[model samples]
Target chain A: MNWTIFHQQVFPIRHKLYRFALRITGSIHEAEDVVQEVLEKVWKTPADQSATIRNWEAWCMTLTRNRSLDKTRDRAQRRTAPIGQEAEYQTDGADPARQIEVQDLTGQVRRFMEDLPEKQRMVMHLRDIEELSYEEIAQVLDISLDQVKVNLHRARKAIRMQLQRVFAAEPVQTRNS
Target chain B: MKEQANIQALLDRYWEGETTLDEERQLKAFFSAGNIPEAYQAFAPYFQALQAEHAVQLPGNRQAVRMHRPLRWFRLAAAAVIAILLTAGVFWWTGGPAQQEQQALAPVMPPKIETPQPALTPSLEPAANPVAESQVPKKQTRKGTLRKTRSVAPEPAPEDTYEDPEAALAEIKAALALVSSKINRSKHTLEKGLQEVNHVDILHKKKKETDG
Candidate 1:
């Protein structure tokens, strides 16, 4: 397909993809990188001779999730693969708020999401943020529906636990953040 | 299947991921009341967020966005493979030995030229074989005589005509001397004057001498 069409189609979906990537990667910079990389691939590629993007957002989400997961896994491991595993966009340009609109609670939510188990984090993103069907989540995550439901419940439970702890630690006046 | 009073047990199971489809249906219905049950009150925000996500517009770019976006690289590789195959097909079409053979078998057309005069000039040239000319009526019967000479006696033309030079010269001198002796002295003086020489003059001279 012509790049103009691909670019125009991809541009409108950038925010959604960025938000999804951020939720998955837990870093605004990484989210932007994933989205830009996906767009670059779509822009420079031809559909006839190559793979066609069936659902651009889902496609971008999968790429973003994998890269983010890879980075997270790499960081968790002492033997880190350089910070550039599947890195695409620059963190320098554009504002950093693209990750989480600068609200402290939002930042906390993002951090807590990162702190959660990877499976749980991914489940929460697919179920809550993306509002995917259990089957769809299962398909994306390569898990059973039961696993999806379990992971989603655990993810929500973790979020609630973090929020409850934050509320208990801080004074009521400032706890909402 | 449980009525309103016992619904919280199913909701708890659902929070714990132990709820079945039947119980989840009850939750959707119970939440539809627009009023909160005290037991389910804390879960309200969570369900509400779910509703919002369900209705959320992601600005779907169907043309560009894909279900499995990252596998695009593999797809690209597949596309490259397809292109390479097509090129191979083209090579097979144009470069096959069969195609070369077809070219070899193609008809060769001679060049066209115009020469109208040559087409009309065949009758003007004599027959190539001199012997063959005798077949035509106007050709001299001498051809038959020559053929008879070749077949009956292998002799040269000079042998038949005047092979003995001395005998031919003697005969010619004797005839000329007789003519000279017969010539009148006064006529010789007149003959010395030149006359118009048509080919018929030779015949006329012979006839005049006979008459004289």
Candidate 2:
């Protein structure tokens, strides 16, 4: 890969790649390694292969996802890792009571997003957080557009349900007060 | 009030994943503006989380990205170590064997006649004694015979005939200083190479100039 192409096209979007990778891998160091590996892989792509890449950002994102998933799978195979370990974004205070006392509602929502199924989590992250278009999301994930929509819809519905459950008691407490 | 109603409608669509990016942005803006109405306060955290996620950048700076090329500094330091090893090897290879041979032969040879004077002599003195002067021709003849014999064997090594410990220490210090200077130069070159790699702004330079 051309250094010029890397610094211009791939370097600027590192944070997006990192967040996507972090969302998948759940470890900051692993995510960074995944991004680095992705960048190096992109950098080493032969000129002909690189020229075929119409969207460097999407290609980089795809690479990031694959690398992150591979790292995650390796981690799982090694340690029989729990899926819930991806809750890196969980609030520092683990207790729900402490969370409520701090009103760390956003942290709770982040944890809910973390608990989402892989497909749904990826789609929601690409759409809501990174703000990629539905087509770009599909392209990065190598999934059908319809699949992206379904996953995104399910992900959003799930998060909303969790949010409501957490806050459903809030109004009652307010009214009684 | 109309804006609040619009936001509420947008929130409903947002939860259903039907809101366009623009509409979602509108909801995000409204929530981030603070002072949410009591009705929509339950959903504020969701939008806040989205906003916070957007703001989360890759930690550190460009250097951290380069650090992904694991152990770049290690490679450079390793090269420096190899270079030092090579220099010391050359120093020993050029000087070691002959000196060892000379040390081995010291007991067999006459110290007074055959021992070579050190190059770094403490003082310039002439061989003025009559007895030594008389032996000069014989010394030359003996040296010539020794040279003929020595030619068939391996060349004798140069001697470190420094009689003063202070002078030897000074020489050692000088050699050490040279090695350290070379290592420092290599370090500077490595740093310069790192700086060169950081010229990642090549693509942005022109745009920045135009903007400036």
Candidate 3:
């Protein structure tokens, strides 16, 4: 991992690392900081040792996760407001009503994710959003293959149930109208 | 109707968390394609949101941003400082070259007998003449006995010369305590680094809140 190799092999995964950090930290600014810190740590690894790493992506992701979790833990200690309370993205150039609807939906999804247990949320983010393989997710999260499957299953099931409840309520509102 | 039935079955498996990656992709594609049947329209947003979230990338050239990161030199300096401290701590813990040399030389040194009286009495008892014991040169007899003992004794075990087991134990405990205290201090330094990294964000957020 000279600068060239770092740029090509390691740095390219910055978005994935950023997304994972963002998902864990639940604040874009904090997430960026986490990614920066992770990258710096990775950069500091001796070039020879880093070159021998079999899975650079997994290594970077694991570092990102540890750093993000540290920040989350600190935030917890400080007794701050729960993260991900605000929407993560802003809609642009859309009809005002449609934008509001999209934002609302995004908020609901974010809340659902934030409400999940830590492992489940992390596993879900890696699987669905980052599209990491089960093995990769396990490596990144430092858990067994079976634990990864179990967490992913629980997370998806929870999200499905919440979606069902929301959809179920929507029709009731329509019926009253 | 057949496609709808296929999706329904897939959705069931999806909810069960049994879908393969390709199957999940098919589900995402179906929901994201728009014009979903009214029955499934409510579920479309979940998939849409997944897509939208995936697209939320950092807003600048990552390489450039990283290169120009704030406190870049300071971070490097901090890392260098930590590396030096860790190396120094490890060297100090292992007691540097003097202790290492002492350990290396310990096995080569001769063993000592603290009480020779009892040791010589048993060997002397096996002698033929107790009356001639006084005539015998004690130094020669002791030297001969020591030779016999050395020849009969098994190889000396390394690190067996603790004068006081309890004191040795206390020394080990103290060394461990020192190592642990060093580790705790390092942990605090890392936590402080994390806090410093986050400080800028906190400041920006406060500024935004005040302006708003």
DockQ preference between candidates 1 and 3, better one: 3
Write the number of the candidate with greater DockQ, choosing between 2 and 3.
2
Off by over 4 Å in 2: A80-103, A170-177, B61-63, B67-212
Residue pairs clashing in model 3 are none
Per-prediction TM-score, chain A only? 0.67, 0.82, 0.85
Give candidate 1's chain B TM-score: 0.26
By lDDT, the best candidate is 3
Cα DockQ of the candidate 1 complex: 0.04
RMSD of candidate 1 to the truth, in angstroms, is 38.1
Off by over 4 Å in 1: A2-9, A49-53, A73-108, A160-177, B1-14, B18-212
Candidate 2: tens digits of C-alpha lDDT, residues B1-212: 99878887887788788888888888878876767888887777677677667755566633266523323544565566567656665655445767657655644554433434323232423464566556655765677456544532233443644679999799779877976777676666556655554453343444433432
Question: Candidate 1, residues B1-212: lDDT per residue as tens digits?
Answer: 25645776766666676655556656655654555644454444444334333332322342244534434554565556556555555555344676555444332211111122223334533457455444432432343333332332112232244658998798679867855554443234323322222233455445533432
Q: Is candidate 1 or candidate 2 better by TM-score?
A: 2
TM-score of the second chain, each candidate in turn, equals 0.26, 0.39, 0.31
The interface root-mean-square deviation of each model, in the order shown, is: 27.8, 7.2, 11.1
lDDT of 3 by residue, B1-212 (tens): 99999999998887777888888889889876766887877677787677666766664644354544434655676676667667766766666888666655643444433234335465665277666566455654566456444432222332454579898698779868988987887667666765775675566446533432
Question: In model 3, which regions exceed 4 Å deviation?
Answer: A82-101, A171-177, B61-63, B68-212
Q: What TM-score does candidate 1 get on C-alpha atoms?
A: 0.40
Considering lDDT, which of the candidate structures 2 and 3 is the better prediction for this target?
Answer: 3
